[model samples]
Target: MASRRTTRRLAADAGLLVVAAAFVLPLAWVILSALDPHANLRVKTPDGLTLDNFDAILTPEITFTPLLNSLILCGGATLLTVVCAALAAYPLSRFRSRFNRPFLLTILFATSLPITAIMVPVYALFVQVDLIDTMQGTIFFFAASQLPFAIWLMKNFMDGVPKELEEAAWTDGASAFQSLLRIVLPLMGPGVSVVTVFSFVMMWGNFFVPFMLLLTPDQMPASVSINDFFGNRGMVAYGQLAAFSIVYSTPVILLYVLIARRLGGGFALGGAVKG
Candidate 1:
């Protein structure tokens, strides 16, 4: 019995180690390949490293514009999504309406709809409105697409806030908007952060929407423009592409680090009552 238990424990540990290595090895390879000046596909320890890979891909036209466009599109969409989701959620969470159940079910259904299913009509509508290739136009769709799920998520977070907090705010002559803004939102910092991160990451990595919507290469986001590095003539610059991948990924990493600190704990409302 003792021998069997020990064997099982060793097997579990070995399985976990294999899984960890599987994920880490690819990332390690990418980092090493990006630093390799020779543009080799296989990651190898460098005898003498060079910054040529970084220098090659650091040009403004290829990398900078796309990155900036990604920031603008993703950042704008996240702001709108978080704000609208919060406002929409407050009523849904607070009110007892017969329509609420069906409405939420509809939103859940919407979340499962693939972009391909809507792409034809969506592009046609964008064309009709003269919104094709426009940043604002692309962002509007981004914000709108993420809202259904964002509202669902925000409602869950908002439900955790006590109505007593809003009641106290109301007794002090506060309006519904004031109660939501001052009392409810602060406590929901984690949820807002989660939504922000979710929306940003989605837009940042999205390739299909921007590709179908935007015509000009200059206005394209990083997700769409990364394809440029892979030449159409069967010439792919591996080192520069790897370096560009690292650079393109920086903003999301920074955002996660900055906002992730607030997600750890819920607000302590233990001493709300006054003697």
Candidate 2:
């Protein structure tokens, strides 16, 4: 039995390694393509590997304007989503209402709804308001779209927390908001981090909304800008496209790694302080 269990564990580990490789292969290809010297506007790969693609993206040949726009939009969307989630979660978690069950269910239902169903009305409204080519408008759209899931995730996490902490804080002369800021927010680190990561990734990766709403090419997100690497022109751009994609995805990869590393450390620290 012991030997069988060990064999099963080894098999599981091998299976996971295969899955990880499958997920990583595309990224590896992108990195390799970016380094290929033949990557360019024409139909032929450059003779050897070079950093020219990175140079073109970072320095002159290709402008960083789209990257800058993406950063601003993503930042705004994250702030909006987090704040809205925090506020909504507080009420939903604490309040007992005859309507609470239905309300929570509705939020879950809304989250499952696809964005495509609402795009037509959303687009028409944006047109009426003259917000067709702006970062603020894009941020607003992203925030609204992300709100339901953020609220649900936060509320579910908060619901598991005990009410006694808040009562004690109140008895000690702390206001409701103060108790929330001091007692509740500290315990909500994991959930908040998860929601923030999801919101940032979604807003950063979104291409359809940016493409439809941003009339000016200057306001395009990096996700949309990547389309320029390919056109009626040819195949040589594939190498450059690969390189650009690798660069674009690097920040997201780093963000995920940083979050994962901090998650356990954060919980440990919080536990120590509480003890």
Whole-model lDDT per candidate:
0.82, 0.78
lDDT of 2 by residue, 27-84 (tens): 5667667787765443343478788877766742244777788889998999999998
lDDT string, candidate 1, 120-182, tens digits: 788999999999889899999999998887887788878989899898888999999998998
Give stretches of model 2 more than 4 Å off.
Answer: 1-24, 39-49, 60-63, 232-236, 263-275
How does each model score on TM-score?
Answer: 0.89, 0.84
Candidate 1 worst ten-residue window by lDDT: 266-275
